[model samples]
Target: MLPVLPLFVLTVILSVVSKPVVIRDSQFNLPVVRKLNFTGESTIPELDRARSQSILKRPTRIVHGDAARAVFDVAATNEALQYVTSVGVGTPPTNYTLIVDTGSANTWLGAMKPYVRTNSSVDTGQQVSMTYPSGSFSGEEFTDRLSLGSFNVTVQGLGVASRSIGFENVDGVLGLGPANLTIGTLFPDTEATIPTVTDTGFAQGVLTAHEVSISFQPTTEEVNVNGVVTFGGNNPSRFNNPISFVPLTATSPSKDFIGINQTITYGTSGFPILANAAGIIDAGTTLLLLATDTLQRYLTVVGGSNEPDPETGFYTISPANFARLQSLFFTIGDTAYEFTANAQIWPRSLNTAIGGNPNTIYLITADLGTRSGSGLDFMNGMVWLERFYFIYDVGAGEVGFATTPFTHATTN
Candidate 1:
């Protein structure tokens, strides 16, 4: 995915839950932008609750695997909302998902006009519905402090595509991966919820390497804020292990995302790896996807080979390369952990390698362009993130690598 052809950044125009909101306070401003990863003992073992607390009064949890899929929150100013609008080639502008996706970079939601319900038309009031493949829901267009623990994003302009996708617990998605015109901008408040980028002077571009933190949001209580998700910095805990922190960089629509950027180290020498890995942190996606070139390089280190695809501009791989695989590792700040190869990788075939006798654990299908799949794996999914702890720090534009797969008794 070279780059998302600068889609008209379309943020949902939300009605203010509270009117005349004041955003003059810079207390929410991230003071520093560190360029490193942190490695240390995870206090995560001690944390055992449906949610944690935070100071800024938000929600915090190291969402991993299934728990991390297609679930995110976004906050932008009215000006930032304008940055999302754009004029489609032959169509009018529509708001997409200002999703803070981790599995994949680039912010995009369902693009459709203010879809009115069928049957009735004439006297029906203009209603918006942001539906997923699952059921139907409603997004109450209102402006409230889009809060998540300490992370306070004042999106003066936003709307709720009430149409439900998959889960009912999630309201909407927030794109934290790359810096497309999806996050910031200034424009005239048009009558429409939020216009496309073509006519709006709002924000239209990409951004990366920023700080985004989350505090646990409980049903009734002030959340504690501290677990900060910096673009590339150490977690301040467990500072001994040689954790590799990736450098944060800017990105395009289709590629990297709002908070997606980092420096990675692998092999004995610990040379930098996956500088552009930021673009591929997608929650909607179950496997870690990379361009064929990048995939080949990573597979090469692990003895994986590739085949020819004829049209898809790629080839096939051996199943063993994906099957009994090595533990894949990623670092957010300084923390580092190994990923289960068996769960993360599931290649296309078992014996379709073009060369080098390498194998794959996951399958790279043609549906990546669109989240479309069928059959058992799609139904009774045993994939990596079928249910896991994944964190997407949109403000900082980086996704945290952690999961609560075990409720084990560990060495303190």
Candidate 2:
């Protein structure tokens, strides 16, 4: 004969056996540093242009919902002139330095440092591959522990690279772009879309809001810690003004990325540099790129030498012409954000780092190769981002921007 326990006793036993649900902090902040990885070559323009083109050619995944937040630190690297962050993977965590990109999504490593697997790493046996404007990699997919600052995702999906090309001085990339961009990255699972670090963190209840906020300050030094990435929510202290947001553009090509709608005009003249058009805000690119017609219009208005400098491949002007330069106004939603004259020019002190003469004055605006009406026209890259506080809200399908201390600074 079996004895039956009382209902109260059974409830007590079950309560003692169950694990408690952990509630994480609503937000986290990660500090990032900048490092100069200059190749001492003058090919930056070509490289930036190629990357922009590659980003435009990527497949678009329509996203309809939103999620929560967390934070991770990032730094500027010299080789590709991008923001890099240290990411820990697997059990006991081996730290890998990865480029932080907002133009594509697919977290992978093993370019400069080989990936180390541990008890927490589970190889999915699925082949994964991704191509970028600057590089490409092929590897096997794995689910592992991914840690950033104090937050941890217990079952994060990532790629372990067996072969790679074009990436230098860094392990791989921390893809912070849209989650849907992960489609077609894995073979045999071609229809599956890998959730991004942000997605996985939110799904695992590590973040309370599915949003990321980024802040960057202009600097002349080759290396500096002047940026921070906040996951789950925005760091209100980073911007001086209230953040204004616009829905992600529905236009194709640009719609595939963190796209938005805006118009650019030159100085007080208010002549259009670019009409209302679809474009992306990308951290993967180092310069502010515009359609060919827009670039030519800007050059004509600015009156700088039409020819690109032989060494740096950037439009150069004499100090006299620079003094006459005017601010470029980028009107997004209802606000007119000013792109100061100083912001348009490269930091003179770092000219030699990009193979330019220290005495030469270089402009940051460059040709995107294609003309307007391409659905994707302009790219507000890092150079433009440095002057503003930016936010990408994946779950809500919106992008936010606010003025920062550096927004109108003459740092350059």
Candidate 3:
């Protein structure tokens, strides 16, 4: 287990509950945003690249197998590659904005905002510490009353960080991934398993199913909090058609998280870009990252050149052949999902935000740093998720996707 030191505790109100409201038996959805410039970055694209690179180093967990899990969804926007949401911690809760992430578990506080002592806060006498690709935190573990959407979890385990780095302008994170990912994140409690909000919700009968579904929409704006995360159930209104579900890929590294298997082909020429590779769908990543081989084929077929901008680290294409770009097709579980040409590029109107020539078009896909056959090849991040409705069904051991209204929009 990682070493840790004691962090001071806050005086929390230990006894407060909302008017006895009946939590919904079905799905609960809430909106989130892609926070920008939280770390004083000049542009959204630069932040996106940094966040994605940070994500690449932190695999969700080192666990070896899959397990039964539950779910809940949160709304998110596309900004700086980090999704933000509001969470109420403690009693008579002090609302703190947090990152809605699937990459890590163990909800914590005290990055930008100090933890408010509440009537519901109880220190568990254990020191907690977690290291991410972007930041690290050391604090004390506490059980508190946390609320979100229409539900609240009593005794929700959380951390109050006394020391932190990389995370700025945010209180902490609302982990939406598996519970087992929290293993070994705390000292003295290293052998203990910390239950996530979803786990607590399911065990407390606040959620019907042990799963959460995420519905993300494509946005062309620099910043917009316009997406929904559905807990306990799927939202048909968010999807344009029936959903297709595929079992999690059995490949190592990938299987320990939300992994899936799919093949990719480029446009009308039917050129294969990826051949049945295993990868993951992560909310924490900003770009659609593919293995080196697949990215080369994509850039080649699109007639685009790799000209990385120092500001954003993304390849830029001249406007001349941009119209010649074709859609990328993904075949998952016998279903073919077409990624529109426009969906592959950054919003041209927001070009200046990333310190790029306003007239130039940049592709949202990037190289994943390694080749195929590494067990984990591609990462369908915000760019890809925005084009489809995604569901991470933990209890069912599958992932679901459907086309959205903005699936074919040329807004970019």
Candidate 4:
């Protein structure tokens, strides 16, 4: 986990920041809609690659889930590094754009934009903060009303930062991770946990179930809102078949998040790359990361080689070898999920955006920094999620996957 500033240090910063506005008889009970943002917007391709690589290098902290009982469309960002949506706070409701992240817990606001204190905002006098590899935000914790779609939460714990680093052009994260990850983010009440919007909604009976389902469609455009996050249950229109439900992995750290156990094989050869390794499904990470050994094996089996682009830190595949590429298979539980040949490569049309030759093909699978057996061996990132329907059931302690229409489509 990303370390937090000591309470004593945080207190000093709070003294100079604005206090929160408090209100009474507040409760939320409506769904919310948020639009997603990609990396290519207002950013050069090189920058997206640099930021992604920087994030990948940091030690990943196992974060824990919450379901947003509302459904909203998601837009593809540059290289699809992140998916963002809009959220409103306060009675008058100031709308802020936020990254929808399931990799870490702790919902906070005000990094690019300052927190707006309205009648529904109540300063808890407790400090809250979270640090990710790409950015960190710290400020006072507050109980406020959050509106998503037609649903709303009467009291939701969110952070208002006084200062931040790394995050740019976004208000802050809307953490859809587990409530346990919020444990140490607040002070004095160190043992107390802040309920995610999903948790509060379920406790208030706003939703019939405590789960969030996500659907992302592959796109050829640089940016498009073609995905949806459904709160409470699966959207029947998103997938055609029954969902394959798999229990969360028993491994520590990895288990703390939406992690699972799966073995990976390459093409029709069925050569094993990762053998039932423990890994996570993350929305925050951009690439499908694998342990170095597994990555090497995958490269060998595909007759591909990784040549790091000095500018972006992402490996590039020669256009020649890309033509001979094949699909990769992820065998999780009783099913084998095929990562099609088209899904294995980044959008060739956007190569120049990431500082690569316009005609070059780049592989989406990259190194996870460490080798297998490190508790976390792989990261099934947004690229992978875009090909499937993912459901994270908080109360049920299970993750479900279904093949979407994009599962084998050559959209890229």
Leading candidate by TM-score: 2
TM-score of every prediction relative to native: 0.36, 0.89, 0.86, 0.83
375 Cα displacement, candidate 4 (Å): 1.5
**Candidate 4 local lDDT, residue 27:** 16
For model 1, the superposed segments whose C-alpha errors exceed 4 Å read 1-256, 263-280, 303-305, 308-324, 347-388, 393-399, 406-412
lDDT, model 1, position 185 = 22
Query: In candidate 3, what are the lDDT values of residues 1-412, reduced to their tens digit?
Result: 0001111001111111222222332222344667653444433344433443433332332222222222344555555355677788887988887787775667888988999988899999999988764568899999999877655789999999999877767787777766656767778968776777766676665665555677776666766766777766676777998999998887866665677899999888878999998887877676788888888878877877765676766787667768777888999998999998899998888777666778778888877776788877887887788889987766567788999898998888
Error of 3 at 164 (Å): 1.0
Which parts of model 3 have CA positions greater than 4 angstroms off? Answer: 1-31, 38-80
| TM-score comparison, 2 vs 3, better candidate | 2
lDDT leader: 2
lDDT of every model, 2 decimals: 0.26, 0.73, 0.70, 0.66
RMSD of each: 17.2, 11.0, 7.1, 8.9
Single out the weakest 10-residue window by summed lDDT for candidate 1: 47-56
Runs in model 4 with CA error above 4 Å?
1-79
Candidate 4: what lDDT? 0.66
lDDT per residue as tens, model 1, 1-412: 0011111111122121222211221322321111001112111101100001000111111111111111112222111001121211111222222323232112222324442222211221334333222222344333222232122223222343535433222223433322223222212221233222111211211112122222111111111121122221123231223323333333322222222343444444554444423333323232233433444556566555454333222333455554444554544555655444433333223213211123322233212221211000111011232222333333222344444322111100
